[model samples]
Target chain A: MEENSKLSQFQPVKSIFEINREERMAPGHRACAGCGPMIAVRQILQSLDVKPVVISATGCVEVTTSTYPDSAWLVPWAHVAFENSAAVASGVEAAMHALKVRGELKEERPVIALAGDGGTFDIGLQALSGALERGHRMLYVCYDNEAYMNTGIQRSSATPFGAWTTTSPVGKEWPGKAEIKKDIMGIVVAHGTPYAATASISHWKDLMTKVRKAVSQNGPTFLHVYAPCNRGWRFEPKDTVEVAKRAVETRFFPLYEVENGRYRITVPVAKPRPLEDFLSLQGRFSHLLKPENLEVLKELKSIVEERWSKINAAASVQVQT
Target chain B: MAQFEPVQTRKSLLTGDEAVAHAVRQSSVDLVAAYPITPQTIIVERIADFAASGAFTGQFVPVESEHSAMSACIGGALAGARAFTATASQGLALMHEMLYAASGLRLPISMAIANRALNSPLNIHNDHTDVMGSIDSGWIQLFVENAEEAYDRVIQSFRIAEAVNLPVAINLDGFTLTHSTEPVEMLSDEVVRGFVGRPPKRDSLMDEAPKSFGLMSLPDSYQFFKDDQSRATTGSSVTISQVEGEYAKLSGREHGPLKIFRPGSKVMMVMLGSYAGTARTTARRMKNDGEQVGVISLGWLRPFPEKQFLDALEGVETLMIMDRSVSYGAPAGPLASDVMSLLYRYGIKRKVIAVTYGLGGRGFLEEDAMRLFRYAGKSGSSFESFFFYGGE
Candidate 1:
């Protein structure tokens, strides 16, 4: 949900052929079970329509796809290192612009990247900040699953409160490791990006729709989409998207967009479900079923409700203006 | 009638910076991602003026920081354009992270790191630490001793970098060579046109066709990626000589790895950059005394002229390394350490003396250079004038 884009009411494309289908992320990649990110990535490539230069940081998507001579990618790619994806992308854009101006360029292309939670939240944040400040025409997709799932299930800054990963496992004295997830979406919006959105595999159409919005516009755009990891969550493989849908329905992971300085929830909460509906499916939250812990969990759900209300109220005020 | 040589010559007097810019300008370099740092600033400033005035047809991107400067240059190079930039001292250090990225990908990116000392409290002076720190990044490093060479080497860099299909750096001492403008006789436009032609590759990425650059490499394939880069860089020495030779043929002035200013002398001072002139003057003085002193100026620093250096120092008992910057906590200067490290491999364990001198942009006078020759120790000494500055 990109509030600014919602407010503008996106205009229709000029041509059907240019329906945004640059297959920078070619099909047939080997990701894990319940990996919502690969779906999100596939939809993004479908929307671009033009070939895009991709600079990927280290993490699951990169490791799984780039396995030597047999890459899941059909595009010509160079993988530098984790902390430098943003830096490397900046170089590609600069090089492309130079070549085009001198008539040395044979084609015109869009440059973007797919960065994971570890890459975006930890190692590559500084480079990302620099890229935004420089105003490169790039779209960065942060596929965040709230934890470091690739490396034996560890806690990350994006991991939610009261979640149980290897580092945040449940214990007799405490109800799993505790701490709230950082407001990464807010940070991107604060950077004053032209387009910023939070989407989830829960709303596939909305997630793919925002990807189109981001690439068409100039300057830097960031999309932080929620991904569910079944291995880490101890859930059945098939319930991945359904779990995500439940999280959104319960308003735990709200689907929304933030653009320029406005905010808008892309998929309105027509029927906000109970938080327990979203929690019961995953084993990570099984411990919360205990009486006292359940009460504490209810308090957390109420906090999410209260936060979404304020955001909705803000959007309504903007609509009034 | 004598046979007439129809020569295509571009002969004009220019500052070292202008000469270098003219070479690149002729190369039709499409992008320049450089910051305004001392010594090197002149090269970029002149380029900025040229780009702004439409004297050259290219994009002059004013990056926010040195990190972005190098970052942007890498992008442009990867996109398949002849990309270039310039920096000095702290600016070079700031770009340290991007250096590995550029070389690791084997992008034909070119940068001029005006040799300057890195800072703690802050000192803006000439030193090799900035470039020396980047020695292992796998860039082809070329050192120029004066304004004329600065112009010449930058021109040759594009050829060497593109030839090796790797990034290249042309290092010149700050202020000494950069700020101090001398009459640089640029080759004719025809000569430059004949020298640096267009790039072979087109824009590597386009909207119609996407490509992945700087992608993630796993442990399984990391060694091969680096090995490929090594092969590309090591293969550059041959192209470097070829390009330098062509440029020399066109301009009638020769320069390359271990280019001998005066060959076959009993005692020779080996060095690079502005101080080389001072050494030559002292060699002239020492030669008059029948001591057989001479000077050997090495233009290429990274793919060092080991064979030639060994040959130059063969008969000489004392090989002096005139280091302008110290390596700090090391036994000798960075260049000396490199020389010593290779001495056993090259089998030239001659008495190579180390001398650290002329830091923070201090002047390295002829008198100071003469003192090293007076010692007859064959080992180089630091320029001692920095200690006795501001005297009555």
Candidate 2:
């Protein structure tokens, strides 16, 4: 009962658009018109109440917002390099404590590390694990666009099975990527983070609430946000959010949270929509719809179902014994 | 120079690593983010002891890798903290990428490099090869010949880095200086505090004013930043000297870009690190034996100290450059190549030989220095050349 009360302080934003809060990310940036990660960044920044020092990995968000002469960030932002955002945030958090020790700083600002999927799930995994294990008071947000969208869509570990990336292109003999997406949330939770979750741009309210709860934690927290890339996924730019929502509704990407080893389905889908509703909107998975790739489609569906069942079991309210 | 009594000190036996730890502890660093690599591990371990015993109040982050160590230092520096880290050889190689980032961002973070040989057969011993790998990384590199100089340079590095807004690397020879204990005079914490002076509040992420750092640059403005970095490095020589001058007032000890022993001798032998001490002793003995020999320790490798080097080269007709690292297919070793380049730039012609020696931490005996000095003394040929000195 007391554990439930610990999470009660986080007030969820009822709706993102209804709030008249000033945008933390300034306009006139270089992000694409329907950039999904940009929307996630905006909502994440808007959700924060306390001043935050944002550390970014080298990716689309860093490049687009922080061009040489101008920057779109209205808050303290740092982009060090690829594969070390978590490590950098660890330093910043440590510095905040040290500064307070020396009486140089009064109030310690929160630290939020942002990275793309490539930075989070692949080259950056070790650093992220170290940061989380060290229990630094910081929030790490991985905007999972499924591939290295900054350097033109190379397949990352976060890329779903059978998705056609530039590296995993469709060929006569070769299909698309053969492997399934890595279970990053499982990896993050294994580090015993105080809070870790999966969210999407479509569910801004849940995402914002998670951000608030993450910042309020005394130790490390993580958010694996499903950021759909329009150009990389080869979808109509305007349908980025719709495709993201389809991912959630189809059970392909579930919205959930793992708090102190306890799992809860924050947004449960009792009856998932057809998987086709999600895959059909993005060209990366269009090859899976063909009859020749019917087995691959079935395999993907079974995998998603198995994952959904597993998460549902984990988050079940019934007594396991 | 202003006249003042040197700060009171007590002498204690300390290794190069311990000397650096003492300096860092006294400098009031806000954060120390470092990974343990041999030859440099003692530094972090001693600082850890300081933190545990309450002698040092700074935060110590045992980072996962050298790359993360540097990355974290950058983060701490950006947050307006006095940041430090230490590494050697393979660790420095791993951190090669972020070294440029730290300097390019103009973060005044200081680092200590226990100079060691890079791995081929995976050896860990004293050599300049490790630091030479980063010769072009746009950092102010200071070389120390012994524990005392290591102690002095570590303190002076913070002043130089903060003054010029560039990172400083104080390189002490692995095992040779890092493990060898010497009586090092210590400065009080209050004295070091007065010297470095509160880290000089820079624009930080923690500041009220929001700012962006490490921005992406297109072709048009990329070179402008690089040019600025280049100028800042070349211009840091002034701050380097000025800091040493101030440190001299308090510590009564000062080191310059070049330490010349027996200046204006027709035959001059030059090197860096602990072996330079051997060369200096050899030169003194040979001078007493009626040989016109000179020895120079090139202390600062970066900023190259063009004018000072040229000045030291005056009336020195024969130059034997002792390098602990190979440049591999270049005309000479790394140090010899730089000196040769400096001479060529000025059209100063002389008999110059680049002799590579003490590689992979091979001990450089005083007799070895004597042999090099005697060899340079006998060489009658004019012009420049290169060779291995310790080969069978």
Candidate 3:
């Protein structure tokens, strides 16, 4: 009678419980301590319940997850050449479609491509654009760490202005990066894809939401996640999340999503903090602190404001439509 | 022993490119990703027509570049689909990086290369430069002499590649064979499909196996993996011969790694691709003129075919190797270099001469083969200087 009563007590809990909870990106990976891209990758992968075939470019994520004879990915993954991840994903998607048509495959699988900023914004832009224009059913995620972190912190087009990268070092004739960051989100939107979004590692809930939304779409979808680099940005390893938070609070990286050619800013900062609060913590922008380089800081701030205003105008038009 | 008789096949007149298209259609290729390049464009064009007409049940991806084409093939193959593509000289060069990735991942993708000259003076003509340049890219290369061989090898390539778990490249001379129409004994779709069978059920990314491919390898493990790949390629000779034998049983046309004519001759010429046809005709004429001459055409460029080459060259006093592409600063051209290496390894010393000709679509005729063979047969002639035919 006591054993029956105990079994009756456990029945209610079992009714409310869900089984088979597993993490797709496993632990024991080679990512550094407090790696922001690793955090973004984890959160984004967790957003998908279905197993995805991951195609990665040659970057920190690929190098860390897949070392020779060992793999950290629990899901199926492939790392092709650096500049052809999207193209490879396009092929995989086509193959899946063909298999389904031929009745060789029964279950549908999502294809996800993970690339670094150097791959997405610079070298792999053409391939990515081709995939997007062709309407491949896949999701491409760019973990934007600002610079080429895998190749030792070289400057990429995604690197912001007034930042010191290996190739954009402060010298007598030059002051850090002379050009502003390339508007990669705008370029992706111009492809007229079904979905495109920008998220940051600090906003885990918002990033995962965007990931789920992107995956739900049928056509090509892109999500650009702002990932802070602790080593490359010259910050304490423990302050990785703190750095990423500051980047969002300062309006340096905005949170927005574009669905079906309509824009919506998800995280709108009512009062953005000064950009200096984010820059002063990272040694990459220490040169901008000099009084002689005050103009560069002003230029950076103006570019940020100009971008925010343009996004706001676009969102308003979308709302009106 | 009974003499082998050719099978009665359904004959059709087709170009090399058309033959390749027919083979792709006949084989159960699930996907084709390709970019249009000169001399190889007709292949994809015909494939597109077939796809549009609902004759071919596959996905034809018109990629933006050859790099993407090969990249897509890698993806499709990783997804456990039979993938195929075709390209020419510049297109092949553009796909150089992905070529290693395909072979390294063991994708078993088949590519048809319409062999053309590489650029610098931008010529779209027949040469071995494209395929020769990629000899070290870890693909099993088969050079065809005509449309019939091109069709047969394309079907045979899929079987060999999937059996050995490697990529195969079927190379035919650009304008010479790709544009010229010839009578080809084509196999029926059912026969070809039965011969190719289904793709081997390997662990692919599309399956539920959750496997990871193309991982980064450190110095400690990189060499071992590369050595394993080398072993797979070197050990594929038996698989190639077996598949060719099986294909012959179905098609009644025998295609071997090496084709020898007039064996055990005093003077012999070795060549690859369509030039072999002209060389064979020249050698037969020389034999009729009471001159002991012969020709050996190499169908398999990779795996070197050392034993077959040695067996064909036995008792030959002099060898004239016809190369359409130069090795540039080496003692001989690419084919001759491998032949010379084999001779040195086996301690067989023979008078060897390399005649590089037909580059940039310059014609290589029967007269040229006769001249080279006669030059090789004459005594007291130094083989020090490599002969460059039809050049200023």
Whose TM-score is greatest here? Answer: 2
Candidate 3, residues B312-368, lDDT tens digits: the string is 877898888888888889988998888888999999888888778888998877787
Q: Where is model 3 more than 4 Å wrong at Cα? A: A1-21, B1-9, B379-382
Scanning candidate 1 chain B in windows of ten residues, the lowest lDDT window is B383-392
TM-score of every model?
0.86, 0.96, 0.95
List ranges where model 1 is wrong by over 4 Å: A1-28, A150-156, A162-179, A232-234, A283-299, B1-23, B35-39, B42-45, B188-194, B207-228, B325-332, B359-363, B378-392
- Candidate 2 A-chain TM-score: 0.95
Writing each residue's lDDT as its tens digit, candidate 3 over A1-321 gives 011121112111122122125788888999999898998888777766678889999999999999988899988999998999999998898888888787888765888999999999999998999899888888999999999999899999999998999999998888899999999999999999989999998887788777767877778999999999998999998888888888888888988999988999998988999989999999999999999998888998999899888988898897887
- Across A168-232, the per-residue lDDT of candidate 2 in tens digits comes to 88877667988899999999998888899999999989998889888778889999999999999
Docking class of 2: high
Cα lDDT tens digits for candidate 2, B1-392: 22212224679888999899999988989899999999999999888888887777789999899999999999999999999999999999999999999999999999999999998978898888999999899999999998999999999998889999999999999999999999999988888888988888788899898999999999999999999999999999999999999999998998889899999998898888888888888888988999889988888989888988889888898999888888888878888888888888999998887888888888778787788788888888765565555522
Q: What is the lDDT of residue B135 in candidate 3?
A: 92
Candidate closest to the true structure, highest DockQ: 2
Candidate 1 on A173-279: residue-level lDDT in tens? 65675777777887787889888888887676787778777876667889998888888877898998998899889888888887777888888987889888888
Candidate 2: misplaced stretches above 4 Å? A1-9, A16-20, A317-321, B1-9, B383-392
Cα deviation at A64, candidate 2, in Å, is 0.9
Candidate 2 — what's its lDDT? 0.89
State candidate 1's DockQ.
0.36
Report RMSD (Å) for each prediction in the order shown: 6.2, 4.1, 6.8
Q: For model 1, what is the alpha-carbon lDDT of residue A193?
A: 89
